[model samples]
Target: MTPQNTAGPLPPPTERRRLRQSRSLTHAQLAAQVGVGPSTLRAWESGRLVPHGSEGETYTRLLTTFAAEGVTAVDGPTAGEGASAVEAGRETPQAVVPQPLTPAQAFDELYAFCAPALVRQNYLLTGRPEVAREAVERAFQLAWQRWPEVARDRDPGGWVRAAAHDCALSHWHGFRSRYRRPEPPPADPADRALLDALLTLPPVYRRTLVLYDGVGLDLPETAAETEASTPAAANRLAYAREALAAQVPALAEPGELRRRLRPPATSEEVRAADPEPVRRKAERRNVFWTWAAVACTVTIIGATALAVRSAPTHYEAPIAPAQAVQGVPPAGVMGPLSREERALQAKLRSAAAKGPYRLVPEAR
Candidate 1:
């Protein structure tokens, strides 16, 4: 359920910016804390939009904390005309209007917003910083490859997170020599123990625990991200928590368990590459594969055409094999002639030399 607003009306846009600056928080950091996109927070600070509902309450509370810390703007209205307007209880009816962003611009914003935390989460998922970096880069590459679908997604960050998690936990990595052996353990004993426990859990359970506890995703969101039923996800989370607590007794409490599920200090080494290079590499790969497919198709077509051109047009019968018979003489053997054949030959020889005469009547 959404919590009620106890922080009262928010100060004007200018004062909110001043308060945030005084606390030395980046837009990303503050937005993360307030459960909003950096762009939304920027809108709040610029007065193009106003915070309301649960988000408004959270923003007001955070600003109140800053104000309580003795950060104040001298020229801006703290309790002046701007505060009076807010106090007058006038609610702005305008929704958050997203500015038009080109594909490149939108992609860059998403990368900037999600990359750092993705690296950290992937590192926690896989104990190796190098592997974490590789998974995140690969995931972003895939995202760029399918940017049209990903950009249209309702939860783009969640989509990227799921991709990275799957990459990190892939069994295919076992075949590669680099990922065969385990990486070195974390330096601190507690971190090492926590990591060891996390690594021991089944991949699905580990992923569920991380999404729910480490990343602060609610049960339903965690289930949706992990592609599991809500009850199944809840059960996995329970089992994972029990196993982790067994390994590290200090993490018995739910709060403590969530706290310890962070990336170890070694995560400092895990850094994602610039988004520009990842996008470029994805495009290059897509182009290479496309040309390769076209070349294969052309080669097949040429081979088929050549075969048809050279093929014989008619069929010829094959000769039967020679067979041997007992009555037949062997090859190249001859038999003597019969007496009747010899007599006929002698008669023809004796009647030669024009001995037979024919009578013909002469014409008158």
Candidate 2:
């Protein structure tokens, strides 16, 4: 396995890449073996489909299996077992790579899962934990905006990581900007005093402490995510826990900090509100249907106009004399005016003459 190398909030792509590479099959082959389509395999490999909670473990297993067998399920030995099989077959069997994926290619799949967390990671680092979020977000977007350059690199994750460090450094350089979002002092007199004391701690230590203790990443995981060497990750995790425990009373409570990191109920579901491609297509269909409706309406209107123009004029029938003069006396509601207006207002005149004439105002 690769040494712990990152401490960013996003899940470490490095570890995933190592796991993916350990296998010896292409992505398409793995998908076939796993009963998934080539596109599905690509999505999983590219890290576009992020699994929540147990899904992470499941992905690890799935990807590992695929890497070993290809998408087609013609299987053999598992990791350690496969190595042993190789040793045994050395005498006669030719060395064959059944499954293989490159580190850069694997990381490409991983970026999406951790993309959003780029912001969260920054927020956790630096004493101005509030701004850490913006820094990470900006860093990730900037990296993404330059993806072509990133893709060209052999270690794209490493490249993006270097970019993240540059972003963090810029934040440090612009310390004055941090003051704009002045941090609220702790309310308690003792705690406030301790909080002030915390500011004097070294920047590196503070970052390590906040991530390992403030956030709930286990030391190794934190180290790997943060890009720290294994020993460094462990040391930072220990020191941060100790420092925070010493300063905050609740933090000293058994598992208090850990509980704080995650609420009691954590469903293994990511609230990915982004619509799937299928949904987008459905929306497009609705738009096309709307246009089709307008076109049909225009067609019907045109047909009606054409029929009216084409049809021969003919006098079919006339209303009976008594029925035409039914109730109203021809003046309209305004009462009779002249013979020209009155001739058309015969019904209105009749209604007006009847007196009650309670006309409701129109709603327009």
Index of the highest-lDDT prediction: 1
Cα RMSD to native, each candidate? 10.1, 22.6
Candidate 1 at 27: error in angstroms? 17
Candidate 1 backbone collisions, by pair = none
Clashes of each: 0, 37
| Cα displacement (Å) at residue 77, model 2 | 38
**Alpha-carbon runs more than 4 Å astray in model 2:** 1-112, 127-130, 152-162, 169-181, 184-201, 209-233, 252-364
**Per-model TM-score versus the true fold:** 0.65, 0.34
Candidate 1: segments with Cα more than 4 A from true spot: 1-3, 10-99, 262-267, 314-364
What local lDDT score does residue 200 receive in model 1, on the 0 to 100 scale?
Answer: 95
- Candidate 2 lands at a TM-score of 0.34
Residue-wise C-alpha lDDT for candidate 1, range 1-364, written one tens digit per residue: 5344455978888999999866645664576677655667888899888787776789999998888976333444344566676677763224343367788887887888788788888887888888888898899889999999988775677778899999999988889998888788877787788889888999899899888877667677778888899999999999999998899899889877766654332434667889899889999999999999999999999999999999989997999999866687668657786899789888777766445563445799
Report lDDT per candidate: 0.80, 0.50
